[model samples]
Target chain A: MTYCVGIEVDEGLVFAADTRTNASLDDVRVYRKLHVFEYPGQAVFAVMSAGNLATTQLALARIQRDVDDAAPRNLRTFRHLFEVAEYIGQVLVSSQVDTAGRPEFEGISTQATLILGGQVAGERPGMYMVYPLGNAIASSPETPYLQVGESKYGKPILDRIIRADTRLEDAARTALVSLDSTIRSNLSVGMPIDLALIRRDDLRITERMRLDADTPLYSDIHANWSRKLTEAVHTLPRFPWELPQD
Target chain B: MTYCVGIEVDEGLVFAADTRTNASLDDVRVYRKLHVFEYPGQAVFAVMSAGNLATTQLALARIQRDVDDAAPRNLRTFRHLFEVAEYIGQVLVSSQVDTAGRPEFEGISTQATLILGGQVAGERPGMYMVYPLGNAIASSPETPYLQVGESKYGKPILDRIIRADTRLEDAARTALVSLDSTIRSNLSVGMPIDLALIRRDDLRITERMRLDADTPLYSDIHANWSRKLTEAVHTLPRFPWELPQD
Candidate 1:
């Protein structure tokens, strides 16, 4: 199980993914779910995956292999972000099908999902959520955020706070807080997290950071959010049913 | 779809449920999901249902009918809260299985879950989550809360703040906050809430309230939790993602 969230805001896009993976409670392990394919100042694409680890890894590797092979058809050579998204979708489905034929995937849910977001030269930054069936949907202004895997526990905060015009830094802050809420509630979403930022029209990666359980900023925010939420609840007027006691 | 939460704290117990019912998006309607069975000062039970509304309603009706039959076997005749829970579990499953045999339910999931918690004449206050399989589990000191249906969106704050020793009033407040989160994140879980309280060893309902969408207290807490959460995010230190300047 995992949790990954991507936000497309006015300042840019924020991506965060938790690293923990588990076959079951007793077979927990850590694996980086975030993959960055970048050409520094030219273009950068980040993909966060959830589902069968082998299928996702193979999909990522296949995409990379296509790019490295100087193949006539590949995401790196795509004319636009949408085309890149299409290429990713096509490659993911093929890889998943190929991997499912192997013994490792028996009885496992082989379906996978990926959040593909980044900037490419000469295009507005774009974000797409690619489904396991090789279809994708781009985030629009009305829904400026996309979440994959263990999404529900962290979604209320995102729905209430995230907007397209939010500053990149603020979006990143919000994404981390969202991650904090999910991690606290679900053992399957355990961290070390991978976070990335992209500036609109920059066509390059701006900032990428890793946060673990001991990270000072994350620790502070987690503790403070809990305390503040409790305080907020305390400040609400007592429900009339219990007013006599109060 | 639904969201209901139950809490057992040192002071007593709190149970709350949203009223929304829908077979699908277009078929949405609101119906009371909380049922109270009371014998004045002798005993009181609050049951909140989630999943197939028909099954839940039938189960509640069956229990009530049995109690009214003046038979030796009924909720009113139960000697303990666990017995009441067992009775509910059996009735809910029988209703679900009965409904599943009908043509209308052929393609639907036969899932139903209930939260039964309150006091009986001779026992301490108790809370149990009754499963569709005629099995149940009681809340304990280590885990004093149980939630059913569309529960994840509202779970984080509860995970962080709720404890067995929390005051009943505080627990009620926390339950509302949790429900508010779910309502925001899930369209299926909407307004018109039913909330009931039982004081420790009181063997009776201490307070019960219904909260509609227009209720000032409900609206205020919904707005305030959102505002407080946004403010809380703002105060968190920005991610040190060193992006290029605008």
Candidate 2:
């Protein structure tokens, strides 16, 4: 199980993901689910994935190979963010289909969910949720946020907090808080998060870093949020009790 | 879908459940999920259900019929909350198996999960999460909270706040807040909630009532909690950034 979120806000786009993968409880591994394809000031695209690590790795590898070959359909020359998302989704679907030809793929849900968001020089910053089936949907005013993987636990916070006009930084913070809520309650999602921020029309990564247990900002946020939540609960008026006989 | 929570706290026990049921989105109904079996000053027991409504209703019917029979394993005679939970679970399992024999039971999971918690004289305030198999586990100091039916969305708050020594009123408030969070996110879980509070040693209900959409307290708590959450998020320090030139 995994939890990844990508938000396209007025100021920029924010992407965050947890880095824990497990085939079973005893078989756990850490994988950086966020992959960035940066070309200095020209373009900066971040792809975060959840589900079927092998399939995701294969899809990424194939996309990377396509870019390395300087193919016309590669991420480098994609004129729009939608094209980039479509190309990535197409590659992932083809890869899964190719793998399905082998007997080993039987009974496996050879599927991966990817969040593709970034800016190309000519296009505005955009975000999309790319499905494993060679299709994708871009974020819009009505739905400025998108999440994949173990999403339900963390969804309420996003629904309550995220808005179309939300500032880039606040949206990023909301994403982190949402992820924190998920990781605390779910054992499958763990630490060492990868977070990326891209300002609209900047065509560059504003902030991109891997946050682990020792990450100062994350630690501060987690501690303060918990304290505030506790305080908030306590400050709520107690039930109107009709005094019982002592 | 439903969201119900049972907490074993220092003040006593708190049980709350949402009242929404649907065969499908278009076929929806409101049915009370919280059932109480009380013997006035002798004992007060409350059961909350989550899972197939038919199975739950069948189980409840059987339990009530058993008590109505000439030879009854009356909850009034139960020496402990554990026994009360066990009796309920057995009845649930048998009732489910019996109903599965009917045509309407087809394709149903027939799995019902129950949270039974309250005080019965001579025992500590106890709580149990009963599975469909007639086996159950009692809540402990380490796990003072139990939830069933669409539980994940509301769980993070509980995980962070609940402890064995938590005051009953605070726990009740927390449970209500949790339910509010879930209700906002899930279409299948809705209003007219059933909330019950049991006091330690008194073997009687302190407060138990149905909360509808018009209930002032419930409405106020929901509005205030939402506003407080938004305020809390705004209060958090934003990500400090030296703006990068475009």
Q: How well does chain A score by TM in each candidate?
A: 0.90, 0.90
CAPRI quality level assigned to candidate 2 from its DockQ score = medium
Interface RMSD after interface superposition, each candidate: 1.6, 1.6
Q: Per-residue lDDT for B44 in model 1?
A: 88
Q: Model 2, stretches more than 4 Å misplaced?
A: A98-104, A237-246, B68-72, B98-106, B237-246
What is the TM-score (0 to 1) of candidate 2? 0.91
lDDT of 1 by residue, B32-124 (tens): 888888787788888988887777778888988898897677887888888888888888888885545678777787678999988887778
Residues A1-246 of candidate 2: C-alpha lDDT, one tens digit per residue: 999999987888999999999998889899989898888778899999988898899999988888899987888887788889888988888766455557777776778889999888877888899998879999997788889888988887777777777777778778888889888878899998888898887777888878776787688777888777777888786566743556
Q: Write candidate 1's Cα lDDT for A171-235 as tens digits.
A: 88888888988887788998898998988876677888899878988888777777777777788
Model 2 DockQ, alpha carbons vs. true complex: 0.60
Give lDDT per model, in order: 0.85, 0.83
